[model samples]
Target: MERVIVAGGGLAGVRTVEALRAQGYPGRLTLVGAEPHRPYDRPPLSKAVLRGELDDTTVDADWTALDCELLLGHRVTGLTDVLETTAGPLGFDGLVIATGASPIRLPGDGPQHVLRTIDDARALRADLRPGARVAVVGAGWIGAEVATAAAKAGCRVTVVEAADTPLAAAVGAEVGAKTAPWYAEAGVELRHGVKVASVERGGLELAGGGSIEADAVVTGIGVRPETSWLEGSDLTLDDGIAVDERLRTGRPGVFAVGDCAAWWSSTFRRRLRVEHWDTALNAPEVAAANLLGGERVYDPVPYFWSEQFGHMVQYAGHHPVADTMIWRGDPAAGGWAACWLTGDRLAAIVTVDRPRDLVQARRIIAAQKRIDRSALADPAIPVRDA
Candidate 1:
């Protein structure tokens, strides 16, 4: 049996192991992790875990119950042909890198927090008291969700973002401008188009002359690929481990997946790295297929979801050349769906509070079918049929 060594027991790594077993690959498997907890679901860490809806139930499958040798609370310092760990060196026929990502931390003292792991969420949740001032550094998804949770707990929340509008870079200003009113409705003070220069004893100084009083400041700017450990390992690391269409890392028996992998995407016709929960859940099956001698390529339609205030937002497909935008319903009225098109083909769809539209939008994007703009704009028409 070919021995398989999987690094970073995250969603991708766990799924790869399960996938390998399901494919009937009777190999020696070892899962390594820096975190002490068993490989758990991370999407909940930002949503339900922050809301205190779940605990360790976040894990997909129990390691002990599965009888897999798990190396938790230990960080893999170096990855040669073998791994140098605290226990001892281990060899393998194949390796999978799924270290995931780390939260962008603010430069400051102990008070500045970030919500990436369960511990980070626990610390932030304990401090959510009524009337306490919170300054969220970035207005991305994490900042938005944290602000919503803080506001619901009766805390005075102020979101400080460098961009003119939240998610301006991701969804573009057209859709971003339309989505701005939700923060105001949630009673969150949005301080857009300003940068936080420094952190003082109890507040954050802006690039401009003003400063905001903050009992707690959270830095949710963004996350980068956790590939620093592979610096001297001769692996191609460009933002992430550079992989081919087959998820191979150029080395003989190494693979990369999830947020830490920048693979050539045939759909986008470029190297792409998606940091969404759906990618983490979906990419490992492809990696597993290739590991078991099956020729498989991961050409998935990138998908993601976010919950803020009372809105459930979902996005499907890649919008590389999305130059035109069309709305299926009124944005002001709330429950609406919008599509970004490139040359008549659906590039991406952003659905707000419309679950059925999102499901239909996915089918439309996958089929590569062109729908009449007028027909798509009319909410009365079935999106799939259109």
Candidate 2:
């Protein structure tokens, strides 16, 4: 392909272009993004950005050496014979869909802040004044992180969750509920099993009766694949753009990666749409290879990490496909890990402030070999040897 257009000028798009050139595709590459700023890291937006510890999270890259055309502030609008953008129509021999996901906003919102961009973080940070009452809707990763930063900023923070516990939808209730204490320890109020009816100018209205008064309100209800532009197209859109093992969509010459893609995983025997920083960082290489006519399979053991309440939470592999969960240590302790297994083989791992466990589990999980259950359960033993 002479011309390749990468939609969404985020981390995934940047990596896709870099991968294309690294794979020796000497062609015209164009990076398009909705944001006006250069590609930047997003994980710190909820942490360091909000804490005012970091002013910029721009990705360290020499765009001049990449030799690709940059289209900032250009949003992909549609696709047909030619790719449509906010700028104008553009023809591409190959297209990489990396438009990523958008944060879900609260319904009937008033002064609702969602952190998905650097600008959003700055705006939210500005309102996080000392003693400012902050009511965060949702107890997920984003909500927890926002609460952590707000609490650190001396704001009276409270997290509201519709589920039984924080991260109930991600990790199971038993494991997720264990983290409820962290909120109280961090001096942030944790309210579970309550749905937010609406967000007003001051605070959130509970689904039941009472209301929460706050100086600032933020929602972390999760995100949806940004595929509105592709809705009119013949492209198959499931939870996201449905792609095969090679990250290629049914549409010829079009590949979907990043958060906006739900690629079939041969490893898990199902489709996975990983909206994590790790996915955007690694998936592009395979997508780029396949886009350049390389028949590379894009199956991966999904991994993601989150920082909340003074804990470094890391997870690797897909636990939903696993059958058993074995704890390495007590969750009440400072550092602990849970191993998800399919029979005797490792399927996933969840580590809380246990970096070494994650590093070891990742290597062992990639091997796809069975281990002794007793050995794996023992925290003192090496996971690699398990």
Candidate 3:
């Protein structure tokens, strides 16, 4: 490819260029970023950035050495043979769509915030002063992390969740409920089985005919892929831009990765669109290889990590709904692990404050090995041995 134009200069887009160069694909590279700032790390936006532990979380890289044109603050409006950006149309021999996702917001408005960018985190942090009443909607990863930061800042933080427990959709009610007490321990009120009807001037209106008075409301329900610009294109778009195992879109010279791409995982035997840092970091290598005429299937045991309420939580592999959950240690204790098994075969694992279990489980899951359930349940037994 003579000119490879990458849209959405987030982690995936930046990594695409990096991988292209690393693979010795010498060509004209252009990175079009929607934000004015250069590509930066996003995981810290909720944790360190919101807590003022970090002034900036820009992705540490020397762009000068790479030699690529970066168009910041340029939003892509449409796509065809050429990308239609806010600046102008630019043609490409190869195109990479790494637009990522945008956070879902509440219906109405208050002093609302969503943690998706550095600026978003900064604004939320400013509002989260000592004694400021903050109501955070959703008890998912972003919600929990933001609540932790707010509580640490001495804000009166309350988390409202429509489900019965935190992370119900991800880990299920039984397993997710184990994290409920952590909110209280962090001095953040946990309001389960509650829904926000609307956000008003003072605070949030509850669906159950109640109101939460707060100085600020932060919504972390979820995010949708930023693929509206590709509406009229022939590219297959489902929950995200649908791509095959090779990360190639239906379009010949175009490919999608990161949060914007729902790629078929041969390993998991399904299509998955993961909105995590590891996917953003690793998927581009496969996408860039394919873009440069190499056959590399993008099948990986998905992994992600989160830090909330002074605990490090990590998960690996796709835990199928039907998989039987096996607990390694007592959840009542501080650290534990829950392993998902498909008839003794390790499918996935979720660990809280147990990095060793996560590390070992990742390898076991990747290898598709079967382990003794009895041994796995024994906390004394190492995961590697199991």
Q: Write down the TM-score of every candidate.
A: 0.96, 0.98, 0.98
Error of 1 at 43 (Å): 1.8
Mind giving the per-residue lDDT tens digits that candidate 1 earns over 1-386? 46887888788879888887777777678888888877777777667777777766455575554446788887777788788766678888888889998887766553688887878888988887899998998888888889888898899999998999987877877777777888899999998999998777798988888889899888899999999888899799998999999999888778899989999988768898989888888888888888777779988878889898879989898775687888888988768887888877787888899888888878888778886778788888877544
Q: Which residue runs of candidate 1 sit more than 4 Å off their true CA positions?
A: 62-65
C-alpha lDDT score of every prediction, in listed order: 0.83, 0.91, 0.91
Runs with alpha carbons beyond 4 Å of true place in candidate 2: none
Residue-level lDDT tens digits of model 2 in 1-386: 79999999889989998899899988898888999998898999999899999989988878888888999998989999999998899999999999999999887757899999999999999999999999999998899999999999999998999999999988888789878999999999999999999998889989898999999999999999999889889899999999999999998899999999999998888999999998899999999998888899987778889999889999999898888889988888778888889988899999998898898888777778777889878888878744
Clashing pairs in 1: none
lDDT of 3 by residue, 150-242 (tens): 999999999999999999988888889999999999999999999999989999999989899999999999999999999998899999999
Candidate 3 — worst ten consecutive residues by lDDT sum? 317-326
Alpha carbon lDDT at 284, candidate 3: 95
Stretches of candidate 3 off by over 4 Å are none
> Would you list the clashing residue pairs of candidate 2?
9-33
